[model samples]
Target: MPLTPQRAHLQFGVVLLAGALLPALPLAGQQVLSVFAAASLTEAFNDLGRAFERAHPGVTVRLNYSGSQVLATQLEQGARADVLATADQRWMQYARDRRLLAGDAATFARNRLVVVIPRANPGYVEKLQDLTRPGLKLVLAGAQVPAGGYSRESLRRLNGAPGFPAAFDRQVLANLVSEEENVRAVVAKVRLREADAGIAYATDVGARDRDALTILEIPDPYNPIAEYPIAVVAGGHRELAGAFIALVLGPEGQALLATRGFLPPAPRR
Candidate 1:
């Protein structure tokens, strides 16, 4: 007896339905990991989150990116975040000093401090020494911001350097344009030519949609290595948070950081 074509089609359809239904049971129970990171990590972490979603189907990622100081303040004020990645260890230390972070954190990336100038270069602030030129507009991050702290230190070093103090007084200190609230704001002002130049992270400058700014690298003799650390915030989603941290420390995450103009995490000294 020849089985009818409709019966054959119905049998195949039933088999397909069962196979599709079998995978749906586990898809509905996936987890979500939330991370609070610095603004500079906007690009890299967003990419990491997407990659993570692809690797772990059904799991979702929620990211809050802002200034490191602001994020730290949020954590202290009881924000719920599984992972907290800071721009520098100082902020993380503050979180730990207050018992905000649960355990030891790992350094996940390093960034270089670079001076950004407007494409217009109206004041002709072209070199590191020119940053201190008198009457040339300049912008810097506020004292609490990581880039500000680094810039202040760099200026001190320049002032102390033999034959450099004169240059610092003439270019950097004299120009004295404005002090910004954060690194991102500093970059933005310079990109808009509101100020002649500004100090910021290389990664920050690289993130700008328009490449209208010129970067002046701090000479090696006075350059400070900037590093970022990741820690788990206490009382947040610790397990999944740790998973996110592990992902940042993993090969895939490191690769993304490198692609975004950051130096890979170095071996502990």
Candidate 2:
């Protein structure tokens, strides 16, 4: 029987509807989860993502790494993502205040600032005080970034140390040759010898870059502990985000973070 025009139009509409629904079909068996994370977590999170995929077949983790402040701004501007992991609690609070989070946030890890220098040590910067040397070039994360805020705070503590002069912090700030948007960028500058030295999270210098850079540990009194937070983003895959967060806080994830130089979260009493 020949198809009438009206019937043909109805058949085409059904086909279009079916096509639209095909992506959501269970047979497709693929789900993509978007994660926005701080730049310092790049390597460790990538490892964790792979572990997650292995445990949950047919799921893929897509990551966007940037400064915590930048990520909060993106979420506020309506960027779609399943999870947000930041280097500090302040930005997580920013998301919560705006009602962008699906549930309470979890503090997963901690980090500390260290001075990174090229393996060659061109500027001969051996200690924190050496950053004040004349003509030395130093790079740091922008003041708005969590790592930057911590870096400045550490310098202030150094200035107040009994042996250090009052102008210590001011002199170190004078050698600033560049201010990057993220801690990873500061590590990159030091690794590439673009700057004599840069302050970065201890975890930012991964195994791959360790050979190219030298880490100068900051004294306990002068170093500020950086707390990392994770939460599910509102209007996203809440279940999946929660699962990922669990994986991060689980034994395997904590072990991985420790191996990568990140400190484990303080035990709850």
Candidate 3:
């Protein structure tokens, strides 16, 4: 039967529609891998996210960064993600106790605390002793933040140091002008000179912040090592999550973390 012009036009339209849909077929199977990580892991994880995308075609990496406790609370409240990376073992234990994790959490990296002061030295915070000086405005992450806990622990150790005052810990705590939600916020407050000083991870003070701040290193004897842990989240894409974790524990990820100022995972005793 000879086709009419109207029938031919309809057939041509169908052909064009099919062609348009063809290019979209590959995207149908593309999946997003969600990662929830602590704020301190921002740079390292962002780089890892890109690397994972490169290693696994058709997969998109979505990273969510916040305080470890905040991330844990979010997960507890029903937020969903494929992986969770925390700054300390405490919160990973929190997830494990609740069965919010699919597997054992491995310590991937370590960090140490430091005190950052404005470059101009407005607070005249010259040494550890100054942290407890009366009227000194100090900012620290809230006690819930892993960095904050490390900071407090270091302060307590310093309090017992020979030269420090007996009430050094209490005095420093009394100097607190702000308690930020995360370590990054503590760095921000110090950079802005909103607080005379802030206690944050040594890694948190990056090259970008060097011009605006000065770091007073905490002695190793007084500084506590902050352990970072990673694991696959419960009900998540286990295979992909495990793969991502392997990448983190792999050479490439560890090298990347080293460049970001994170210490290698501590050797097991």
Candidate 4:
């Protein structure tokens, strides 16, 4: 029998109907990896996220930045995330203790604490010891924050130094006007002149705020190094999470972190 136009049109219609009846599938390689990271990593991680997306087509990187402790609590409460990056080893250890991590956390970067004052020099704060000046308003991170813990440790080490008073730490604590939730908030308080001075990570004063703040480097002896650790969450996208970690530990990520003032991870034994 010879093929006819009417029969051919009917066959095409049936094919279209069958295609429409099938389940719709996602595009190949399309995936989303949600990352819960420390607030201090905001800038660097954002840049890294973009870079990772560019390198891996059809993949999206979602970032949630907050205090390390805050993020840990969220994970403990069952928030869905593929990876967790913390500003300190303690929080990563906290996650490990709760069985939230798939493997051992890897240290990715390190940072140091610094004293920042408003560009106007409102308190005549030229040295670290100046934080104890009478009536000076000092801002710091909340005691639970990694940056805050480092700040307190640094202040305690500064106390009783050659020129500092015996009760220097006590006096500085007395002058605290605000305890912010994160290091960036402390930077903002000082940058906007809301407080006379604040303690923050050295990287907190980036190029944008360099003109708005004065950064005073803390001596090594009195400074505490903040170590960053990253791990894949137990029930999230494990393969993608590993890939993201590789990018972060690779040269490009390391270079980007260094450019943002973060120190390279300490040598592994």
Candidate 5:
């Protein structure tokens, strides 16, 4: 039977409509991978997200970035996170205790602690110990941030440095103005000159305001080396999450991290 032009047009339209809807049908029904990571990983992980999307066109990688402690809390509350990257091992352990993490955490990056002061150096804290000088407003990260823990450890080590700790204790107690929620917050207070000095991660200080603040490098032995760990969340899109983790640990990811002032974990340690 010869088909009329009107019928032929209808058949072509139906075929085109079916083809257009085919690609979305399976994806619309598939699950998306949600990832929770530390705020410090924002820039690097964003790059990783784009790379993951390019590699797995059908999978979506949703990311949440914040303090590691906050991320841990969210995971504990049963938020669906396929991958969790923490700025410290402690949070990973905490998550593991709750069985929220899928596998043993792998250390991906190392960070350094630094004392940052306003660009003008109003406090004259040229060295770490100067942070203990009287009347200087010093801001530190709240106890929850890994940077805060590292800062406390470094301060304790400094205490053993010939009256440094006593001076620091007295000065810090007197001059302590604000304890921010994360390293970036602490850095911001200093950059804005709201606080005379602040302790923050090297990467956090690498932000654009770096020139607005003077960075005081801590000595190697006394400084606490912060390690960032990566793990997949159990029972939540594990395969896709694990792929994201692998990408983070890969060369391309590490290179991106290094450029942002994060150190790759030591080969032997």
Candidate 6:
């Protein structure tokens, strides 16, 4: 019998639906390792992920990037991942406190905050104090984010610096017109000219970013150095996760991270 148009359409729809579900199909003798890491680790971790896959055949590295707090919240809500890396000790502690970790979290990297301005210099920002200029639009990550917290702390420290005004931090905070969920979002808004300036990790201002951004370095004394922590997740693929973590803390991984502008882990106290 000749197929009718309606019946043919139904068969096509079923084929498309089956194709959509293909990702759910399992592959024999293959392993998947899921990693939940902070947004700031995106560049370095992506390189690390690729390196991990190269060394381990038949294994896939699934990476999830977001604000450190959001990652912690997701883990709290039962997100399935084999490894967790955060931009600060706070969220790593958040996970540890809730027993979401398989072992002690290791400090794997460090980063410092910097002020990023559009190359166009829309607000005439030349230095840290310029952040206090009235009506100057500024974007910052939400208070919950590690970069956001470090940014605020660094700003407050500026108040005590010799050249800055006593109300430096407060005035700067008043100019904030938007709060982003992650450091990258803050950088994106500043680059887009949606805001005059933003605070983000120094690593964010890559060669590509430099094309559109003018980075002003914060003083060493006033800068807040962020510590990054990584660990295996409880109830995850512990052995594979440990291998990944070892790679991150190893010479090959450290070199890869350095190429992407991440700092060596601070010396143990």
Winner by TM-score: 6
Compose the digit string of candidate 2's lDDT tens values, residues 33-131: 899999999989999999888988989898999999999999999999999999988899999999999999989999988999999999998877788
Reference-based TM-score, model 3: 0.89
Per-residue CA lDDT of model 5 for 1-269, tens digit only, reads 78999999999999999999997776685567788988878878888888888888877777899889999998898787789999899999999999887778999999888888899988888777777677888998877888888888888777658646654655565678888787778887888888889888888766577679888898898898999999988988777888888888898888878888899997963
Model 1 agreement with the true structure over 1-269: per-residue lDDT tens digits:
68799999998999999998997676466676888888778888999999888877778888998878998998899888888888888998999998998899899999888888887898797667766666778888877888788887777667658657644634575566777767888988988888988888888876454469888888766767788999998987787778778888999889988899889888878
Cα-based lDDT at residue 196, candidate 5 = 86
Error of 6 at 64 (Å): 0.3
Instruction: Write candidate 4's Cα lDDT for 92-204 as tens digits.
Output: 99999999999989999999998999999999999888888889999999999999999998889988988988777899999999999888889989988989999999888
Q: In angstroms, give how far residue 207 of model 2 lies from its true place.
A: 1.9
Expressed as tens digits, the lDDT of each residue in 143-259 for candidate 6 is 999999999999988995898999899999999998899999999999998899999999998889888999999989999899999999999999999999999999999999999
TM-score of each: 0.83, 0.88, 0.89, 0.88, 0.84, 0.96
In candidate 1, position 191 carries an lDDT of 82
Q: Which run of 10 residues does model 3 get worst, by summed lDDT? A: 23-32
lDDT of 4 at 171: 92
Location of the lowest summed lDDT over 10 successive residues in candidate 1 = 165-174
User: In model 2, what are the clashing residue pairs, if there are any?
Assistant: none
Encode model 3's per-residue lDDT on 1-269: one tens digit a residue. 68999999999999999998997786577898999999999999999999999999989898999999999999999999999999999999999998999989999999988899999989999999988888999999999999899999889888768899877899999999888999999999989888999999988988899999999999899999899999999998999999999999999999999999999998889
- For model 3, the stretches where C-alpha displacement exceeds 4 angstroms are 1-29
**Runs in model 1 with CA error above 4 Å?**
1-30, 166-171, 207-210
Q: Rank the candidates by TM-score, best first.
A: 6, 3, 4, 2, 5, 1
- Predicted structure 4, TM vs. truth: 0.88
Candidate 5 residue 151 Cα shift, in angstroms, is 0.5
Error of 1 at 160 (Å): 3.7
Top model number, lDDT: 6
